[model samples]
Target: MTSLDIAFLATGAITVAAALLAVTTRHLVHSALWLVLALGGLAGCYLVLGAELVALVQVLVYVGAVVVLVIFAMMLTRAPIGPSPDHSTSRLHRLLAAVLGAGVTALLLAVLLPLGGEVVARTPVSTTGIAEDIFGTWVWPFEALSLLLLIALIGAFAVSRLTRPAGEVRR
Candidate 1:
């Protein structure tokens, strides 16, 4: 009906299509790449909703960090890059995922929609204040998370090194 509505619809469509492709693709690497597209589209949708900080976090955290971590994990585990020998997700897993997704959808609708189905107005949030709060009060937790990630990296390296060929020297 309007330009903003059209933009939202377009972003939502891209997100759905990319998410479907991500799940359905046979190739592992291609699935990860498609996931990036899906994540980016969701971030775009967040941007269209005026949630700039959320969009940025979605792109930076999910696409940049999580997806990269997954890709690296796949490489580290020596997962097949081409078409998987078997489906990426088993039939039972897919069925469970569908059920979980549907349940979440129902829960959200129940919570967000009013008894009369009237829309609720929301006030826009300021990104500057959020950034200030994150950098100031929440800095310690952020640093702690960084330390935890470092420990995880060290553990991964240890595991990989231990699993290397017997003749190979420890790194």
Candidate 2:
């Protein structure tokens, strides 16, 4: 195998591992941190695949913006840092979830196994073309999404503040 292939594999492995940890961890902040690692690893995988723009977007949009927003929301809401017993599931629920996950994995493998032998040629994409497309055609949607996220952040802050007792006042 080539070095690029090895790098892709390594990054993919790291991404999967981090994603698993992000989901399975009981601590809220730790899960968000693991999500950052997962998203960063995904960006690395995109880089190894030679999609520099995609890699940058992955890093900027996911790892930089989304994960930061998650952490910020957590802090704004005063989320528990450590494990909470209230979030724990019973053994039966855990077992069912595992079984469902395995079944979905098997289904995906079954669907993708037929395409394993086929190699599709990739066309080179220019960074400028992508940038123009994003900024020109999709600019409004992108700006709208950003505005939506900002609104959501503000809403979270408002809700968190409203949760205080009647006698409590902001300093």
Candidate 3:
């Protein structure tokens, strides 16, 4: 195939491998780090596909904002950095989760495969158009999402502050 196809395949493989590692890892912080790698690999795929704006957004939103927020929340809640026996699932649970994930993936493929042949003739969307659509039409929803994230950060901080030692005096 072409160079772009090869590049995309490489990036996709990296993304999939990183995602699998992220899910399977026992260490909490390591999982988040793997998630960052997966997201960055996804951005690389977007870049290979010539979606620079989408790649930028993927990096900024998912890698920079979401993963950082997740790490912060984890730290704030005092989540275990290393492996915890309490978080381990039984073999049956793991098997069932894998089966469910595969079933959903198959279902999605079955539904979407039929639409693959219906190619619509349309002009390529420009970065400016997308920016306008996001900043102009979808600004309110974006702002609301930001507010929700801010509230979550505040909640995490509040929860963390409430778990002080018995001997510690309140301010």
Candidate 4:
């Protein structure tokens, strides 16, 4: 196998593991950090697929903006840091999880095995075209993202103000 294939598989495995950990972790902040790792791995996958624009956008939009907003929101909401014992799973739950995981694996194999690992040709997409599409057609989503960032900043301000000691005067 080519080095790119090895890198892609390694990155995909990291992405999947991080994503699973992000959901299963008992600590809130740790979940967000793991989500960042997962998103970074996704960007690496995009890079390996020869889609530089997509990789850049995945890193910038997801890791830079979305993850930062999530972290800020967690901080603003005073999310728990340490693991919570209550988050522990029961044996029944573990069994159910294993079943679900195996089912998913079976489904993926059933789908992909039929294709015989065929490589589909993808049209080379230009950055200029992507930029135009994002800015022109999907302008509302861009604006919404900016709004979300603004809201996160405002929430951070409000949270800081609330946590301030009562004796401290606002500047």
Best by lDDT: 3
State residue 85's C-alpha deviation in candidate 2, in Å.
Answer: 1.6
Cα lDDT of model 4 by residue, 52-100, tens digit: 8879989998899999988887776666578756567888998999899
User: Of the candidates numbered 3 and 4, which has the greater lDDT value?
Assistant: 3
Pairwise lDDT winner, candidates 2 and 3: 3
State every prediction's TM-score relative to the real structure: 0.72, 0.89, 0.88, 0.74
Looking at model 1, residue 156 earns an lDDT score of 59
lDDT of each: 0.83, 0.89, 0.91, 0.87
Best by the TM-score measure? 2
lDDT of 3 by residue, 1-171 (tens): 999899999999999999999999999999999999999999999899777888998899889988988999999988878988888999999999999999999999999999999988978888898788888998999888788888988898888878667899643
- Segments of candidate 1 deviating more than 4 angstroms: 86-100, 110-116, 136-141, 164-171
Residue-level lDDT of model 1, residues 78-157, one tens digit each, is: 66788755546778988999899899999998987765577669676799877888778988987786687667666656
The order of the candidates by TM-score, greatest first, is: 2, 3, 4, 1
Worst 10 residues of 4 by lDDT: 78-87
Off by over 4 Å in 2: 166-171
lDDT of 3 at 35: 99
Root-mean-square deviation of Cα positions for candidate 1 versus the true structure, in angstroms: 4.3
